[model samples]
Target: MTTPDVFMPRLPWDAVDPYPFYAARRREGDVVWDATAQAWLVLGHKVARNVLAAPHWISDPRANQAATAGRFFTADTVAANMLFTDGPTHDRLRHAVRDVFGHSFISQLTEGVESLCKQAISTIDVDEPFDVMSQIAWPLHVAVIAAWLGLDPAQCQVLREHSPAVIRLLSGITDTDTLHVGLAATTALITEFLPAAADRRAHPRDDLLSYLATAPELSLDEVVTTAILVAVAGHETTANLLGAALIRLITPTAEGTRLADHIDPADATVLTELLRLDSPVQAAARTATADQQLAGVHIRSGESVLVCIAAANRDPHVYPAPHQFLPGRPGPSPLTFGHGAHYCLGSALARLETSTALRHILERRPVLTATPAWRDTPAIRGPHHVPARFTA
Candidate 1:
């Protein structure tokens, strides 16, 4: 058995800035085998897409128990949702939730999302240096999602408090104890709400949860998991995107202002450009089902591969001036929201939330500009403390 050629480099965990590291990696080629991590790093746009779309590649960590055991995710909390499944299983769950979260359904929530954005923006301390992540981004997402689900306002606060811990775990920042606590809190939230929601379905209500409850094929466990997925995935991903987008907006660049001056707020293409430049979900891993060769590199069965979406988005050959943020840049969409069958279900909702939040910020606080203190997380990238002083 011949050992695969491996390009060993330290994981960019300690780097205050990882973009440069990713850039260096991308310069090497599309697929670089990482010997140290015992995984292949897919960095180019075409390669990442192929990797994501490949049927042979498995998203379920259980496929590679030894590699993912103590690192990527805890087996106990990994839900068998569409995100982790492939083929028929993914198709079933996706269809089950489609009516509730499809583009048309999510579009209906735009007005409510905008209202929540306005309300959240109104509370921002314009004169003081505020942590935008806490003051605006977090609250905006929490309020919009809670209202969409018809969750109690008080319970939304509990979700907010518990959510950061969950986000930490998802972002690969939490230890075992923290992960357990976060998972338990999240699971408990679902357990409490699912029963009431199930009852609400019998009576009928005009909310996302009620719509979800009506899914005939979905089990109680699936319902709970789905709801939990919405709560966590819906809010956290968009919150981070908002934070990242704000950082770009305030960075004192022509590209930033050009992006802010867009005519249509709901333009998915422009948002795609922004995401490509600064993706929130930076890396996602998958396991190989069988020994396969990609771009002339051998990937053994059961070994994990981490697709660097951020790096792939910036592949120079595919994207001109990849480092520069161009709102008008024309190209393929980024993989921030994973590609193929596992594309993010909450993608439309996320875009709506981000667009509304950005519009509110630009309209109310035109002079908003500041350097951001970025969060320490490998999986999700965002500003931890974005101090901005805005004048009305």
Candidate 2:
């Protein structure tokens, strides 16, 4: 197909800022069929939310118009997870481990998490720039998830090693060289977590891994896969969220006290605003189960819809001064964690982790002298490395 046919196969501003591209396209209409991705891109806040929660939208690409004859990377690695499944299968998996998100469960981790957060910040050399993504965000997330899973927190090194490749599995990078990385990541993660699940079964304890291992409702593979899901999914996205939030907070416009200063880290609104302004997972794909009208655009059955959460969060009609990060901004929640049936299972944990991390940093009062480099993935947004020099 010619350039005119694709209109812009790869968006021009993808490497840097893609918001202007989205805003320009959004001005034409809320949902438009883009030849680039060969999918309907939903940009309006209301319309995107509607599409996400709609009954006719499917999460799995194969369930649509047979988008691919086989899986994007390896057959079951990406396909077996609940994120791609819909209906009873999804519900069965979700219900099997829903208790992980309970208030009682999350509330118990506060003390331990707070200590870990402080410890993570303390390790940063007081005189030089430290990559917070490695020193602070990544380790803290791995530690929390590990502790909860009944695994030694020291094993975070494996997670640290494989996180990037595993992340690529979800970001839709399935080219030959990248697919090998994705496959290797998937194998390593499952290999590590499965044995732990078995050990949990052999020696039952008062922890999530043990509970899953013993749960009569789950198969052994389910226990292992779900544990891997919890361990992997629970932290990285949250790490990304915290990483992105930290970068934005460090350089809040030269106002008297930075929003990170006077604001209560635990305050939901503060996190909400931060999430809206710089979302971690910026885009998601949904397939149309049936023909539907979204913002007056006719969508055929078995077509794909790309829900641009980053764009929707900044919809001017829904949020005033959407581009600016205003911690005090009120009304309308951010869709960063999503909404409806598949809303993030780990959102509570993510919020608690981020709030704790930020509070600890502010107490130390470190001056970040340089900006962090943002991740290159088109859909997932966060710092691959957050460089900060600690100055007392």
Query: Each candidate's root-mean-square deviation in Å?
Result: 4.9, 3.5
Q: What is the lDDT of candidate 1?
A: 0.72
Which residue segments of model 2 deviate by more than 4 Å? 1-16, 64-70, 73-79, 252-258
TM-score of each: 0.87, 0.90
Error of 2 at 99 (Å): 1.5
Top candidate on lDDT is 2
The 10-residue segment of model 1 with minimum total lDDT is 1-10
Q: Ten consecutive residues with minimal summed lDDT in candidate 2?
A: 1-10
Error of model 1, residue 165, in angstroms: 2.6
Off by over 4 Å in 1: 1-11, 14-16, 66-79, 125-128, 168-178, 201-203, 253-268, 366-370
Per residue, candidate 1 scores C-alpha lDDT tens digits across 1-392 of: 22246332224533236688787776677888666455678888888899899878877755643332335454534554556667786688789877767889888788888788878778766576677788888888888888877788766877787776665544332344565676677666776677767786687688778777777877666666677678877887789888888766655654445445544545666677777777778777788888988777888888777788888888888889888766668778888887988888888888878887887787755444555677766667777877776676
Residue pairs in collision within model 2? none
What is the number of residue pairs that collide in model 2?
A: 0
